[model samples]
Target: MTNTPSNAAREESLDLASIPPLESIPPQLGSPGGSLPAPTVDAGWNTRTKALEVLAILALAYTLFFARAVLLPFTLAVVLALLFRPVVRYLRKRWRVPEYAGAAGALVGTIAMLIVALSLLALPAEDFVRGLPEKLDAASVKLNQEKLFKSFVSMQKKLNGAGDLGVSTETPAPPRREGEDDEEPEGDDPDYAALGAAGPGAAAEVRQAGGVEVEEEDEPATMVVEERPPSLLNRVFSSAPEALGGFALAFVFLYFLLAEGDAILNNTIALLPTMAEKREAVGLTRAAEKGVSRYLMLVSAINAALGVCIGIAMWLVGLPNPVLWGVMAGMLNFIPYVGAFIGAGVVFLVAYLEPDFGLLDAAMAPLCYMCINLLEGNFLTPAVLGKSISLNPLMVLLSLAFWGWIWGPTGAVLAVPLLSMTKIVCDDVESLRPLALLLGPRIEKDDSASDSPDAESEKPAATAAPAVAPAA
Candidate 1:
């Protein structure tokens, strides 16, 4: 026992020596005695990094805005390529046409149809233009005859006169002859020498007849012809060469896109780091293309039907330029909510301006437009597009506003398709699924109650309860 105690004392001394004093011991990270070096706070570096990221994003936006001249055509080409890709593919597969030839044929066919439609409407458009002045005059005269319009105009004039709106109503006094009273000149001022020279014999006869001039019949006043500025359509046509060049470039881009679509797609996929990433990218792209193309096709058909219905309705109502309104409707319908309203406004204005149409008759055009839009928006689009292209109305409006702000009317026309494409991509990306969900319309769940705690409690009790034995 004494030897054991001596040995234990020696071991304790060794342990104490090995352990060292607490002050001498090196502190470990995250230990009770030490912190993790205060996390090496490089706040300045973090701030700089965040600032750089923000700057990069701003630069990218700036580049997109300024380079839009080049980007717009390419972007339009991509969209068109996607749209006509199936057509080109069909021609190649079915008829064994060369890819390039098939793409060219499909593009040319589309262009020809557009040109034919425009040509058919050209005469009517011209007539509408030619008759615009007469129509305006008639509308003005009718408005002036209306008591409400007259009262409104008089009130507006009075308001203008009362307010300091820079309008002057007082006439300046007529100039007075020097050294004479400001009295009217006596008995019909003598004709000027230049005018008398035109008919010297009449002037001589008047002088011979004791200065009593036989009044020559008043000459007809010359009509002053004022030139009007060219119309918006005319101005657009005047720049057709530039527009056509851009269109040609877009078509060329589209042709190559369709011709080499597989190669391009494969090359893009090859750039991904892994097979899974590549597959995901491919799936996302195909989904976007399919969704956008299907939406465009269905919307186009629906708009075409709407145009026909509008034309027939206008014809029955005896509205002028029915075809023009029809074409306008179809073209503008591509712009979604805003476009429909604008088209309806155009119809209403035209109907109201018709010389022969009364107020009730004028109202028919807009009424018809509303009914058609209602049917299409409520029933037809939902039935055809279903839930695949469904987007939150708020998101749709915001997208429309954003794109329209960026690219004007063209962007507005392309907004829905672009939004649909974006949603498809976001849905395919795991990280971006939240964005996809935000874009989707809200769906009320019937099973929401079944997912509650009360439902779970009842479910367990119902399942666990034993059945009582039936009477023998």
Candidate 2:
């Protein structure tokens, strides 16, 4: 029995030796009884590298935040260039215009349109500014009368009392001398007297205490007026030269990009090592351009139409500055969900504050706006954009918040387009396809996977192969 066992062991050892080494064997043949070797994992180094990459990304984001002044205008220009590129190309090809001339013409035409739009809005804007103070005062008074404000005030008073904060709520009555009539205070009406004397170069000697100014001189005095520092808007307008310089730089960049279009593309593609990579890069670039440009153009057209409808509706409803409201609505609509709300809020406020419109009439403004937004969001956008460029609602909101934080309003405006482009690029690149899938909306599995006859037939072969492995 011992000899027999030894003989069996010797035969098994010979059989094992006859087989090739796992490394030397063809992978397909070796897989019959053995699993493929697991790939080596470097837990420490990989974690370190991942951390460094994250740090680098954070550092880049920091740099972008600080550099936004230069970057914002450039980004705007790129978007504009993309928008106008097709027109420029058409002018060059159809009209036989030189590239430089076509670029200049496109740029000038855009500027002229902007100037015309601004000119149309100037009077309305001026009127709005002139009446703003009164409107604000009225709004403040109205707000104070609201139950919410009253409750807030009461809560604050209770808190103050509990803390013994020494807050006062007293109003002292004016002293009345014997035989002095309350009606004999004509000169004490500062506003009436001030209005009567109000004109250019009119001045009064005033003593200011606790934000209240008391006029000492009733007569019109030569006012040595002290110039107040410029406001935020004023400061921005005052830096027009810097703005213009940035615009000029952007225009220059746009011109070159439009002019040397093929050369730029060729140079970019040439940087890649393999022909396949170059082709892929070119394809991705074209796809991104097509998708982004088409989206922008379609959205612009839709917004323009919405603006016209808003203008007509406001006009029919007897709203003041209908054109102004329309333009604002159209412009703000570019910002997605937030934009529509902002535009509606402005309309609601204006309507509510208007002296001519009653509460019912004022309510119509928001109602109309809401209806328009409903139609646009539910019907128009989906029908127009279709499935190709559709993005997840959560992704859209997140992109909006991210870009809004990074680049402010401009960033918010560009967020969807940029996100769409990023998704497209990710979808095209093999390694990034997973990210693209993640960004995309969820898709339900098809019945074909389970119902296919081929799949059913293959199940037995698949199970048999595994079962046969152990026996082999």
Candidate 3:
């Protein structure tokens, strides 16, 4: 190798030069003198950080609760905007309509249609309202006659220590002493005739008892002692202003959202730094919008169909107010799980209150309603919605509970849509993919975990391990 510029010599020299000196090489982690491990803050700091995150979440919840008056309408508007997006688009594309014009027409037409429908239903609804008390009283009487109701009442009475079901529970008058003069209280019942004669005059002093006279002044007979219960008209008028205000605010928000939603979305997407981020933002927004709108529209249609089927069934069974029940079923179906049961219960109660219905016959309407619900929920919904908008049943219930607690019935109605939106967002974001998986109907096992660094590192070692042959 002397004085020879050989390939091996050159290569060896290169290798030697490439190898870093021991002093220059960093110490390995976990070694005694490893480069002072990245300085970690106190564990207390981490605990404090976690506590701050929890407090942030709690504050968010508080804000949502307190701000519901405004937020509820805005949320409703958002959902409605998504739902109406297609209609507005159609109008714009087909007739060259302005976004504002299209939105206005759609919103106005819907309101008008609602007003007309309400007008049509008003007579029957009014009649129903008027007779509701009578019907309820009759139903109560019938219920009391039932063995089960009677048993429940008796059990309740027993629990309250009120003696037998049929026996009077009132306290008996105290037994009079044999020598007692029962009729000696002459001044106890003062003459009201004298009081009426001297209306609003000086206080009247009755006969003295133990040398002390009791004087009583009279109030005007015309003055009311107790207020009459509020009438239906009064109640309706009282609520009208608030209800109307809410509707106005909601519609105003909806109109703007419908008109400017696309522009807002575009602007939002444009603000993202990278092309990827912009694309991701657009995709996420579009997917969320589409998913929510499609789910709501399809569910609405299904509910309408369910309502129709139920109404037809009711009519066939000769039940009163089939249309009302149908509309109620359709409306209530917006609320998942609970809505169906509520509609069914109402139908059952109404059916049972009918004189012609035996207990079995009364059950028919609710059974029919439930059958329709089962078909729609289990078969139709799954098939139509598929997995895109599908959510975990447990998650849905949790959302319902949470949102309901936050905003009451309106929140319950909105829970599924809000959850769907959340799932869409989670699905789009890489970090939140796990949460999306959790929210989805099926939790898929992550096969990608096997592709982790440790596993990958072990793969080569296992492959490179020298094979040992068995010695015979």
Q: Could you say which candidate leads in TM-score?
A: 1
Which tens-of-lDDT digit does each residue in 1-472 have in candidate 3? Answer: 6657687799899999998755343445346855544555697998999999999999999999999889988999988898999899989999999999999999999999899979977887887778788877787777778898889888887888864357778999999768666443333345334433443222234323232345888867896689789997898899789768877899999999999988988888888899988887788777777766787788778888878888898898888888888888888888889888998999998888777776788899899989988888999887776656668879988998999999887799889888888887787678998898899843233534466788789877877665533332
For residues 1-472, what per-residue lDDT tens digits would candidate 1 score against the true structure?
6799999999999998997445333355346955434345676998899999999988976776677667666888888887888788788889999888888788889889989998999999898888888988998888788787889999999988898778679998998668865443333445335335546666666657776546799999999999999988898889788668777787778889988998999998899999888888888887777867776788889889888888888888888878888888887877778888898888877887888876677888888887888888899888877666568889989988977877667778778878877787776678987898899942324445677778888987776565432332
Kindly give the stretch of ten consecutive residues in candidate 2 with the minimal lDDT sum: 200-209
TM-scores of the models, in the order given: 0.72, 0.67, 0.70
Clashing pairs in 2: none
lDDT of 3: 0.81
Worst 10 residues of 3 by lDDT: 200-209
| Residue 7 of model 1, lDDT score | 97
Per-residue error for 185 in candidate 3, Å, reads 24
- Against the unseen true structure, what C-alpha lDDT does each candidate score? 0.79, 0.79, 0.81
Worst 10 residues of 1 by lDDT: 183-192
**What is candidate 2's lDDT per residue for 149-242, written digit by digit as tens?**
8999999999888989676799989887697654422454654365346432232322222333558878786879898999967987898787
TM accuracy, model 1: 0.72
Residue 265, model 1, lDDT: 93
